[model samples]
Target chain A: EPEVTQTPSHQVTQMGQEVILRCVPISNHLYFYWYRQILGQKVEFLVSFYNNEISEKSEIFDDQFSVERPDGSNFTLKIRSTKLEDSAMYFCASSSILAGVGEQYFGPGTRLTVT
Target chain B: GESVGLHLPTLSVQEGDNSIINCAYSNSASDYFIWYKQESGKGPQFIIDIRSNMDKRQGQRVTVLLNKTVKHLSLQIAATQPGDSAVYFCAENDNQGGKLIFGQGTELSVKP
Candidate 1:
């Protein structure tokens, strides 16, 4: 089965440094999303992207965060300035219109460690 | 504010037993619900999903039950095995841009 895949399984960066997490969604997927989970907490929605634009974003997705679909398959999330509280597991997900709008397939996730 | 939450933080059962995990969502507008399993160090894997129009759905050895009146959801695993141990999470779609709101996970432990 085709699955979403992310690069740099583990990332370590210092505070105030910029970090970009990359994801290659399933080739045919039309909608993409990013979510994060702090240790021992529930996963929180960050943002959703479709048609090369942000469709929706949560309060946590503030000025520092941005998402781009630079290419057909590559979707990326960039943090302009990393904060210690940003340390968490960042997950990328995608869904095809045929798969139903709500059924999303998730990638293994990139563990972001902000020191 | 909208949120999904698991009723229990952890559950232990003997191998070959059945397991039922419960969740509650405050968002009445959520029309879609999904159950996911996360093994250690891995991402959440899709288990099964049910739409608001359907009260129950089954797949493989798992079944999902949704009660719209109570805004509750449950995932039941039949004849659980040791490999079924993981942190299970219930998520509801906010219906806005398909953003999913996930619940705190319930850790399932199967003892042989």
Candidate 2:
């Protein structure tokens, strides 16, 4: 089965530095999303991308966060300035359709550690 | 402001036994629900899903039951195995764009 893939399985960055997480969603997928989970907290939605634009975003996805589909296969999330609280497991998910019943497949996830 | 939550944070069962994980959702407008399994150091893997119009849906070794009236969802695993040990989460879709709201998740441990 085809699955979503992400690069840099783990990353360590200094506070105030910029970080970009990359993901290659399933080839045929049309919708992509980013979510994060604090060490012991529930997974939280960050942003959704479709048609090379942001479809939806949460409050946590503030000025520091931006998502771009630079190429046909690559989707990226960039944080302008990282903070200690930004350290978490960032996951990339994709779906072929936009229906509510459609199943979204998740990637292995990139663990971001800020110090 | 709606959320999905699991009743039990953890559940343990012997290998070959059946396991059931329960969840409660507060969003009455949610029309889609999914069950996902997550192993340590990995992202959630989709298991099964059910629509609000359907009461039950089954997969290879899993079954999902959705009670729209009470806003409850349950995942049943038959003949649980050691590989089934992981954190299971139930998510609900708002029927908008494919955005999903995930629950706190339940840690399932299968002992052989």
Candidate 3:
């Protein structure tokens, strides 16, 4: 089965540096999303992208966060300035269509560690 | 502002036994629910889902029961195996889009 794929399975960056997490969603998928989980915390939604634009976002997705679909296949989340709290497992997910009900397939996830 | 939460933090069951994990949602408007399984460092893996209109749905060795009246959901796994040891999470979708509110998660350990 086709699945979402993310690059840099694990990332380590300095506290004030900028970082980009990349994802290649399923070729035919139209909707893409980003979620994060702090160690020992529930997975939290960050933002959703469709038509190369943001559809919905959470408080955690503040000024430091931005998402881009620079190409037909790549969806990326960039943090302007990484913070210690930004250290978590970031996941990318995608769904094919909006049929009132469809499953969102998740990637293995990129573990972001900020020093 | 609504949140999805689990009742239990951990559950231990013997291999070949059944397991039940429960969840509660604060939003009555939420209509879609899903159950996901996550191993140590992996992402949440989809298990089964149930709509608010329906009371129950079954898939493979798992069954999902939704009680919209009380805003509750549960996952039942039959004949659990050692591989079933993982953290299970219940998620609720308000249906506005694809956003899902996930529960705290329940750690399930199937003993051999």
Q: Record all residue pairs in model 1 with backbone atoms less than 3 Å apart, i.e. clashing.
A: none
By DockQ rank, best first, the candidates go 2, 3, 1
Write the residue-wise lDDT of candidate 3 on B19-98 in tens digits: 99999999988888999999998989999988888999999999999988888899999999999999999988888988
Error of 3 at A68 (Å): 0.5
C-alpha positional error of residue B83 in candidate 3 after TM-score superposition, expressed in Å: 0.8
Residue-wise C-alpha lDDT for candidate 3, range A1-115, written one tens digit per residue:
8989998999999999999999999999999999999999999999998997999999999999999999999999999999999999999999996413988889999999999
Q: Give each model a TM-score.
A: 0.97, 0.98, 0.98
- Candidate 2: which stretches are off by over 4 Å? none
> For model 3, what is the error of residue B105's alpha carbon versus the real structure, in angstroms, after optimal superposition?
0.3
Every model's DockQ:
0.63, 0.79, 0.66
Best by DockQ: 2
- Rank order (by lDDT, best first): 2, 3, 1
Tens-place lDDT digits, model 2, residues A11-114? 99999999999999999999999999998778888999988899999999999999999989999999999999999999999999974858999999999999
Error of 2 at A87 (Å): 0.4
**DockQ: which is higher, 2 or 3?**
2
Name the regions of candidate 3 deviating beyond 4 angstroms. none
lDDT of 1 by residue, B51-91 (tens): 89999999999999999999999999999999999999999
